[model samples]
Target: MRSNAARNALSGCLGFALIVLAGFNAAPARAQDQLKVAIGQINNWENQAPTLGQDAGIFKRHNLVLENV
Candidate 1:
């Protein structure tokens, strides 16, 4: 059997998670939304896909705003 402290901690965590989820669910929705992202490449070879994706406007189509670091 679990100790009382352990059980209390677990229940507290579960309750906090539930409240956070409910808060998100109660928030208003936006019609147009974009998420900012930064893409970094280790070398020239790794940079090809994002470059091509930017040229192809694939990220814009998916409502993602990518940035380089």
Candidate 2:
């Protein structure tokens, strides 16, 4: 039981790390200087953050072209 708990904890930590790394790898805006992002809908917070960020000039500050289609 103790070994199983340790393995589970290790896996959980690794999974969290994987997600963080993936997020970093997914957004390489500086390398391109421009990006075309497409969202299916903007009816929720998940779809709203980017729009708000763009409206707030955050994406332009970072030299990105985040568009919702």
Candidate 3:
């Protein structure tokens, strides 16, 4: 029927739109992307893990730049 054709056309358009939107967000980050970590304002050893790891060059070995905030 004509209504079935119309429905199929709408669904095809919607599916195409979803695929395009997904493609936009599916791109991987470039190598060594700086990642911002939210460490609480607590100035304790537990909260300094990211900073310590960064200083020790642990994240650098894994191609990650940690920015603790």
TM-score of 2: 0.45
- Find the 10 residues in a row with the least total lDDT in model 2: 27-36
Best by TM-score, which number?
3
**How displaced is residue 40 in candidate 1, in Å?**
67
- List, residue by residue over 1-69, the lDDT tens digit for candidate 2: 479889999999999999998988895545526666777566877878877898999878777777566
How far is each candidate from the true structure, as Cα RMSD in Å? 11.0, 13.0, 8.6
Estimated TM-score for each candidate = 0.39, 0.45, 0.50
User: TM-score order of candidates, best first?
Assistant: 3, 2, 1
- Considering lDDT, where higher is better, how would the candidates rank from best to worst? 3, 2, 1
Query: Residue by residue across 11-63, what tens digits does model 1's lDDT show?
Result: 99999999999998995754545555456664677766766786799977776
Single out the weakest 10-residue window by summed lDDT for candidate 1. 29-38
Best by lDDT: 3
Pairs that collide in candidate 2 are none
Instruction: Find the number of clashing residue pairs for candidate 2.
Output: 0
